[model samples]
Target: MTSHQLTAGICSRLNEPEHSDELLSSTPIVQILSVKRVGSTNGPNPIDRYRIIVSDGEHFLQSMLATQLNHFVDDGKINKNTICRLDKFTCNMVQEKRLLIVLAVTVLEQSTTKIGSPVGLQNPPGDAVASPATAQQTPAANALSTTSTAPAVSSSTTTTPAAVRGQGARSGRGPNIFPIEGLSPYQNNWTIRARVTNKSEIKTWSNQRGEGKLFNVTFMDESGEIRGTAFNMVADALYDKLEEGKVYFISKAKVNLAKKQFNNVANEYELGLEKNTEVEECRDSSNFPVVRYNFIDLAKLQDMAKDALCDVIAIVKEIGDATEFTSKFGKTSLKRELTVVDRSGFSVRLTLWAKNAEKFTHTDQPVVALKGVKVGDFGGRNLTMTSSSSLEVNPDIPESHALRGWFDAGGNSENFQSHTNAFSGGGAVAFNRAEMMSLEEVKVKELGGSDKTDYFSTKATVMHLKPENIAYPACPTQGCSKKVFDQHDGWRCEKCDRSFEKPEYRYASTTVTAGCASADPVSSRYMISMAVSDYSGQAWFQGFNDLGEVLFKRPANELVAIRDRDEAKFTKLVEDVTGQQFNFSCRAKQDTYNETTRTRYGVQKILPLDYAEEARHLMELLAAPWAQ
Candidate 1:
């Protein structure tokens, strides 16, 4: 042994509560037995801390270097079998264990050279042995080793603030609540006292493997949060007992790695309730963290990519009737659409599925709070509920209350920007397919009279394709078709803030299609601007970009390139489509151009005419009351 060697026996004395403070003042000389960085379980932005095991020849104890003294370990001044003295320190109770907090340290023997092996008890402190690379293990860190059930305690026992304090002071009688971060599959004997932040609806599943029902609850403590799931019998047993925002002492449950896809909790492991699991409600939950939500504002939702998951709180501004639909697999499900608005002056659509859809009732514009909702893009910005998601109407959270108050105070009447991308035509198209309408009836009914755009489909014959001014040069950026200006060096798009060496091409054209056989000069030209006759009437229709490509049977860029080469070739191409019949889905609305308000028709979709379907539609129109 070296002359300055201080045996591990002197270090073990610091573990005693009585001698800890005394030794901190009179530095204890010990050898650094082990040093490693502690793995932080906290979400992002974890602090760097080092845990060290030190020995004084006769005994050794685990300790942590204070943040200020972390540099000693980080700088390589502390290593295995290195002699060190606690120049200044503080010993305090952390998680029921006397933890030595090194405030300052002095190296008696540099770590540049290694010494003989540890002098104290050859084993590390606590129940588990530590390797040089292993982090220091205090009782709280190793609490997972406690395999026995926690002491039996009645749920009805008093858990008031005062009673809780009394229990902690009672020494052995106090409850041993394991930190959530300390939980892992390797340890089965531990109890966690946590507050239920959210509980999902019970969902039943059937598959080739088997059939079962399950429900999940998200729980959190001061240290961390995790999700617990109960399946079949276990789910049935605990569904009614676990209430949101209530604390419970849960034990005898299986812990496993959590699924990364659907969960948002920071912990990597999840708990599974079994037949032997015990859950006793805790009356006093003041110490546990209340439901914490990382809410995404409505306006910020626009910036999120498709299929993102987030939590949202907003006021239900509009509710659409629940609709039932059959899937390709023959499974029937109900879905309801809700338009929710927040203080951000934007409104978004939220979809509820199955039971949540069937049970939802829109009354008094209640505020809705959703957790772990999946972001979806059908036409525009919308949210969809996932199996693990939970929804609460008129939740008592602060944001809910604030929205309710604002809505009652004239917020409801305020004009909010709608994020729904559905076309402006009211009932223009229901779901993904357009409503069928005849050109004569569309003219008589004034389908686009309302402020909103209307969508309708008609089968018509192309009278003539206007050959003049057919195509335009468009921005070259992907997904951007805005026309660009011809700069001296290159084409420039102010909207995209980009300059391209060459511009892409697209087409917009006016095609005259007739949907009326009788062809009343006025009514014939009414539905369409230019003339071509169908079974009902002649009308002018508009086609642009994607729609134009369908009519021309080629890409707009190719057509534009061919047109730029020879105008006669483009004119011939347009004339070739004359008298061709096709089905067209169109958007009709009134707009002012050149200070004159006129009804404008634009083609939204174009496809080859289905003769059988067109015949059926004509028969339906003939038997209508308007025809009579």
Candidate 2:
């Protein structure tokens, strides 16, 4: 490499907007003097950012590498003494210093020695450097100039607020458009030009502190993406203005630490819209980037733990009819189940809730891309879309187009393996047959001792039942099973805000239970604690309504009535099931109460002894070479 290969003094020319077109017409090549990692690794955004000192042969300037281009640094493609062409970049003033944001670069050649004796650019003679206070008074300096005629302000020259505002207005953007990846709580007077990729419905919440409404929207630029939220009055004002896939110039919003539990955007900082926040739609947004997804294959879902969030793109193999169900809290909700398959030859059920469920009408096997869908383990493995999740039907992305092509060309005829068990959690144990554990093996292996819950199956005989507190008087509401207070006149349910003449009796579980899906408003249920033992050891397990019915062959309400009217019959009923053996699907979870941590086992499903299946399994085991 020689000095002539570098674009000498191009760094100085970038500061002068009058030469933007001339510079844009020809690519500027520069030498990488050095590269250094910046940003806090312990911060909410732990991703590494690189800052490089690039030389135009005559003068050296500090440049920040766009996060999207970090691969160049990591892959050693661009390094010290390497010459590269600056494909796209912008100049910005930060804290009274000129900073170059390198958006795109192309590596040309590598050299072992420096190409030129480049000196650092200093303020021109007699020019006054802007003070920190003066810097704060101006708009962000990263905004790209729309035209070559836009006046340029040197970082060393102090300008009045009016002039800075005028320049921004003349450029048609309120301020310099900051990249979403560069946003932080420390920056002030910065604006971002980005497209809204997704918007959520306004959600209202009530708690001890009162009630408020809020909504979230995801914004994406060429650099990266971030989540923005508006609350209460602000939410009401901006909810209608931020439409999906529209570009806008947003300013005056506060950047805060992201709440990782609520969102899946890669960026670490999120924006909070305030009353004074400015959001102006940009009509000329043809250059804005569309939504990006980090999709995972369906076959890999088995390796992911429950409650993990993932992005996926697959063909809609089947769609179930929308069904209405009352939630445990008495809210009526609608849901639809979708069987989606990918080229990985695996299928998983994707559940859409509320409006998304009711509005889906696609039947032509459209390719759907979902971001932030949660993985579940209710039966085996499934997916559920939450408030932060976004869905696109027949997206134009390369992945979607590839999946569509594959499906149309005989991929639909391929048999895909399902992750879920068809009969699991309904009336029998999982048909997939989870790893069977003995009571003693479960204890020895320390299952459910971790932060996440552990599930397994076992065969155990019922030993005894804890007779006390087996049933409680519950509200008669269709969905609510909360305990009701018996006033002398009537049963009162605080949650329902109503009173009834009589409280319905229900079996009480120590832990939360799902609501019944049956049509009957008032059905008998049970929540009981029973001891079960296998050949190895004995352990206590919590049984809910379904398990209770399977074990006792009767409803909890009848047992409670029998216990009250005839103690002898209830005692006999309990004793009759004591020695019965069955297959149990159970979950173990550790909980802390009063600083005491203990593991609790809950029965998720129960299955009777299948003599024929058992015999076949035994025969297969005996025929094994090791057994022979």
Candidate 3:
């Protein structure tokens, strides 16, 4: 850090001789380094803190400097010297070695820094003391220039104040700057120097209503990276002015809290440049912090959900679709998924979004730096990236090239990720597809067919099969699925209190069990058989009155006998439709007394006649085929 880096301010106080005498005698000397007026988060306070990296050439000056600095003020708007006590000093040790420097009141802690006024420095107590409070408001150096007209005096002629000079004013303090580099807690203004790493190509957007530009840039520092955006007018200039790898000073940027649900970037916050922000291209880059992360551990990623922001790096394994999507803000975006595996025997899925996604897909193979990717969970959980995120592909980084060759040359580190089901809070139970059937009690192979070729086992139902090709008259009442009329010679309904010869359509189910010994998913075929026939065919179905008399009476044991009558035909019919043999299954409702399915269809059938258009639409979807 150079002294020129420190700014000079307007200090028109030394003009007063009395004020000058008090300043030079009471306060210790100082040399300012850097000054910044920062806004405070608490209350409405602002601070004008100076990074006064100080050193004392004389042993006596050390205690005096401490006493003065402890009383320094940081009220952003207060331009007066508020150096009250030198005891409240703070320092910290930095890993890098740096020269210990000292800071004095350079007058830069005020509005701006420019060496324009030598006369202003000559004046002591620019603003005369209205009362005793002004006594402490003046810087001691102002005394030298305060009495320009008085008899010129040097330190040899001056007498020290009543307080001891070098007897250690602060308690337990050590050999100050020798043991440290900077202050601890390192509190400073949001000062950053970043490079415009890949500025977005300038593009204009205009519509019938409005037009604007959405320009973006990636930012990198020693700590890691983040992204920033300029919308509309602001974007125009930045898009043209900002160049890649060029450092720039940034301030007054609006911080963006990342949308964790959408982005896969690791930063807690993204940022957008506000209209009032100050952005200047800096000539120096050495002072900028280089962004980096040690990559704590990869195994922890297994527990993270998709769309989580994280910093991860590993060699590429496979890439997926480079499909495009529209963002919620109406901007166009693209995405692609990749499988990234590391030495931890874990392969995490990475979803790259937008331009990065496109770039990754186009690259043949690149060892990448996925610094701020967000983890997400779509159909499957994985990592994603947002605009605030940054990516480096095949950069000249050691971790990148090394990981690439390490995984490529016979590394068992390429092991696929383990699923949550594989290892639970309990433990892992190793089993393959072959052993799954036995464990699940399922039959895999099917029975052979006629011509003795081969056969398949399905589980379908014997729905609507009559006792011996049966017949029955249905009830005439509306909205009733129950079979009301049951007669040997004539017709009568005991429930509806009506004599009936005509019948209404009702839900009549098939009676058959369907399942494989293992999984019982699709074997039965259920009401789908009836639905397919009634849905596409011209045949009207029998009402529930007929179903109750024929199929529902016998238990499943008795119904199996019919399978033997024409085993080939039965086997072929089941095999043709489901491609599996029928098994044990019955289609029963939650309530038997309700005559449920029949009642449902009964009411549904009448709606079309009564409500016409609505009924027609309802009838279109609410049928057996739809039921299937």
Give the whole-model CA lDDT for all candidates, comma-separated.
0.62, 0.71, 0.37
Among these predictions, the greatest lDDT belongs to 2
- Report the number of clashing residue pairs per model: 28, 2, 71
Off by over 4 Å in 3: 1-192, 197-211, 216-228, 251-278, 286-288, 326-332, 361-364, 412-414, 418-628
lDDT of 3 by residue, 331-414 (tens): 787878887776666666777766667777544555677655655433334566655556777766677777777776865344
Error of 1 at 576 (Å): 42
Tell me model 1's lDDT, rounded to 2 decimals. 0.62
TM-score of each: 0.47, 0.59, 0.37
What is candidate 2's TM-score against the reference?
0.59
lDDT by residue for model 2 over 1-628, one digit each (tens)?
Answer: 4533788679777654233334544678999998765432222123556777788878777677776677798788988998999876666555445667776788988878997687766533333354433322323322211000100111222222233334446656553656665666656768777778778888888779999999999887666677899999999999999998788878889988777777655566788999999888866665445655668899887655456667899999999999999987677889999999999999999999987898789988789999778888777678999876788999877888899989999999999987753221321224223258899999998988998767778889999988777766777687677778878878899999999776667543322122332233454557779999999999999876777778777677666767877998888888898999998777788889999999888886678999998896686567433464
Model 2, residue 149: what's the lDDT? 10
> Candidate 1 residues 354-412, lDDT tens each?
88899898767888888768776556677898665678888767778888898899999
Flag regions of model 1 displaced more than 4 Å.
Answer: 1-126, 131-174, 261-264, 286-288, 326-333, 420-628
- Candidate 1 vs candidate 3: which has greater TM-score? 1
User: What would you estimate as the lDDT of candidate 3?
Assistant: 0.37
